[model samples]
Target: MFTSDYKYKDYIQEIYKTFSPLSWLLKIFSLDSLSRGNKQKFASSYWALAKGALTFTILAAINLFTIYYKFTWFYVELIISVKYADAVQMIYDLCQYFVDLYFVYKYGSDVFYEYIRQYAYIDGMFGMEYYGSIRRRLINVMIFMISMWFSSSLSDYVIWAIGFGLMSTTFFSMAYIYMFIKILTNLHVTVHIMHIESRLRVLGDLIQECYCSSVSCTARIEDAVIKKNWFYTIKTKTSKSQLYPLKKISYVNSNEVKWLSRCYLLLTEQVNFINRMFGMRPVTAPCWTKGLSQGEGLPIITTLGRRDGYRTRYEKMQAAYKDLLSLVQSQPINFHMAHFMRLDYPLLVSICSVFVTYTIILIQSI
Candidate 1:
């Protein structure tokens, strides 16, 4: 029952044309297409073997240099042969392998979410896509725990000492990383929630506009009337409750009803998508707070201890919800407002900072 004011479909087409190749690359990995020759070959030749050989060779050289610097000029005599060193050297190589795999999984999913954000930008220059990729990367990294543990084991201590001052720097900074990840993930979830909500509001406005328009109303009134009668009939028959009678006193006709029904179905589908996006499907463990009221082990972000900074953000989100309510009540929903509402700007800034800090750490480590 909704009508577009402008040619949104054309814009969507343009976005797809511009961004399809990137999406296609992500889809290749996202779908787990291990059997595909290109994927398998890429993994074996470029990722698996090449990376493995290079890392092992580097580690062996490092071991040789360590021995030579410490003791005699005959580094090979002090240690086993470089060939034998390859075996123990593989330990470091294995670490690097998993770290690289973790990076692929991390940044790969990040790039995919980034594509989604870019598409959203076509709808409007909404910033939901801004930190969306960060959240996806963080969550993927968290879930990909095996790779993280392996990274720690493979850490080149000597390299880190020379590069980053000392291993103790990373050790001391670990909690910051964890906190940043948690905050980023939570903010991401909230942003996604806002995006879906905004879309629904826009669709709702479109439906209202289409129905309230002169041409569509005139064309569909007869259909709306017939369907309204059928609706009452079915509903009355299905329920024995006398709370309200199935009144045949409805104004809508069949065509209008049909149009509205289609609109309602679309809206309902969007709702379902929102639920799924929030991870409410097959209900898993909650991300942040659990209880209705904040308490121990709650993800519901409350102000206490060193968390006072989040209070302002929490209030801002609450204010955004208020704006959402006002938009839903207005005609021709303001998607610009709705779009902005989905992002917690403060949280986004924080997450962005985390990326900056982590990148600095990674660079320093290297």
Candidate 2:
């Protein structure tokens, strides 16, 4: 009932055209397909593969060089001054780059293209005003990304150049490129989820309309009969609720319910797919505090009693350590699955219950 006359292939092409700018950005980083001629071919060609390797190699080289330079020029002084925090932070940032790079390389354009293809198919399943909304959102996102990229790129260079000298600007620029790619990846997934959510809402409205229509039909018939007997003016008061009593009368057919359920299921599966593709380890403030205490504060604490004349510095370090310890102890460490369920015994039980429930549903359907 909700089918559209627009061809699926044509629809996909239109979507691709709308998102060409984003694809172009990914192409510059060698993270997406090289050619725009065939939206179906998501895998990069041999040349694109070589380009990607070269791109990664250059980034790796810059990172390694930056690390070497920092250690050679600033590491000893920072350690002597008890300011090695900067060095540590740089290490963490560089590690994040490598981690993101690994994922980008592993998934590449094929996974993203598949996501788009599946999104288009599901979106087409429900007849909604497709092009106008898609284009508006895509354009807004493109504009935001472009502007953010420019502003961030400029800021990174200025900050690094002032802090670490002009030589380090190139290193930071490479890092920013990877960071931008990661942001784009996340943005794409978020946009898909939003589209899926809209479709699910439409499905809900359709089901509601089905029920409303049934009730309205019954109401109209009652009104017609009452109007026909207009000569019998001696009428007793009758409420609308009395005329339309709630009953176990199925307004929607089983087949219609099945169809709606299938649509809901498809949307849910797509959400799961997006989650799996983009899932990362959740980090909490308590975890970071604990790590900092163990990694950075422990050594300071061990040497506190041994230090001879740095009494004031030792006092400050002791106070900081106390604060860190207190913070860590006060906060409980609990991991949650996207804040939906805690990773505890209860979650395990829920998983088993879900399995049983689905099994029952399968048997009943058969």
Candidate 3:
């Protein structure tokens, strides 16, 4: 009697379907919006996508034709060796593997080119913004998701291995590209900072030159000058040098110092935020953690200046930009790769594993 009781499960499913009118309508609308929203951008993105698909299709057809032509003798030989069916099957599997690899390589290249087109111009000229960097990866991410969804096969092991391989390659490449972008952006940002310093020095000199006849000050204010960094040397016609200590800001008094501290703190936060976005801990967080954790008397990983040392260290450089972002806020949006291109050890290691596995599979197939 219990074995024949299908009514219970059917009743439960029916009950689940019996939501109130308002809830049903709400669910329908939500689903509709989601479905529509997802494809909204595809209308425009599709044209280029179609051209890419067509090109790939032509290439694949040509490749297939050529391979068949060249391997015609092998196919005849395999047909003659009817007892070696397993070996023939392996050869077929090997050909399929190469075909899959070709598609992956083609798709990855297209997506990467699209990224370059969208970001290379502006990011090349100006430094990338925190969020801007990660947003750049959205296309590649979408491609990865789509590939994973469509690439599933009847063989779970092969599917898993291949899927993992493609994903690993995608993320590893993304992380590498992001690191390259970060280094380049940082270098450019540093150059821009140097330019700002030079302009400030020039302005200070012009001020002294224009106001020399109006003021009766004789002793140079070199001693009064605030130092920001060691490499940041500000010199004048009077042979007086304004020394800036490492990571210090040139400010007038205690108030400026406080302001600079806050500004630097914010910049530190931004850098850390970007690092976190890219899966790295901010260098400043340890310091913030160190002070707080010490006060609280806790022995957590949050402690700053740990003997083990933190992974990322951009607080000193980014601190200068904290106060400067007010200007950035008013400017048009900028893109950066600092936030998007992060991959953890798990991700990195897994990717390598996937590649090795994929290589082995390919070799076996061949």
Identify the leading candidate in terms of lDDT: 2
The sequence of per-residue lDDT tens digits that candidate 2 reaches over residues 1-366 is 214445666656655665564667666666555356544455654555677777667766766777677667656655432334444545555555455445455555666666566656655554443445555776687678768987978886998789878865564465566557656665554455446544544443343333333333353444222231133222221111111224533344434434544555565555555444444422211111112223322322233222221233234433433443343234312122333333345666688679979865754454
Q: lDDT (CA) for every model shown?
A: 0.34, 0.49, 0.31
TM per candidate: 0.27, 0.56, 0.23
Q: For residues 1-366, what per-residue lDDT tens digits would candidate 3 score against the true structure?
A: 112235333322222222221122222212101111321111233443454455445544544554454355334644433424434443443343333333323332334234222222222212222222222333344345435533432244355447666533332232232232223223323222222233233323322221221223245733111221212232433222222223323232323223333422333333333233222222111112111211211111111112123222334323322333332223211222244442333675588679979866765555
| Candidate with the larger lDDT of 1 and 3 | 1
Residue range 213-240, candidate 1, lDDT tens digits: 3222345444332232232111112111
TM-score top scorer? 2
The TM-score that candidate 3 achieves is: 0.23
Q: Which residue pairs in model 3 clash with each other?
A: 128-336, 132-336, 133-336, 133-337, 227-244, 228-244, 228-248, 229-244, 229-245, 286-304
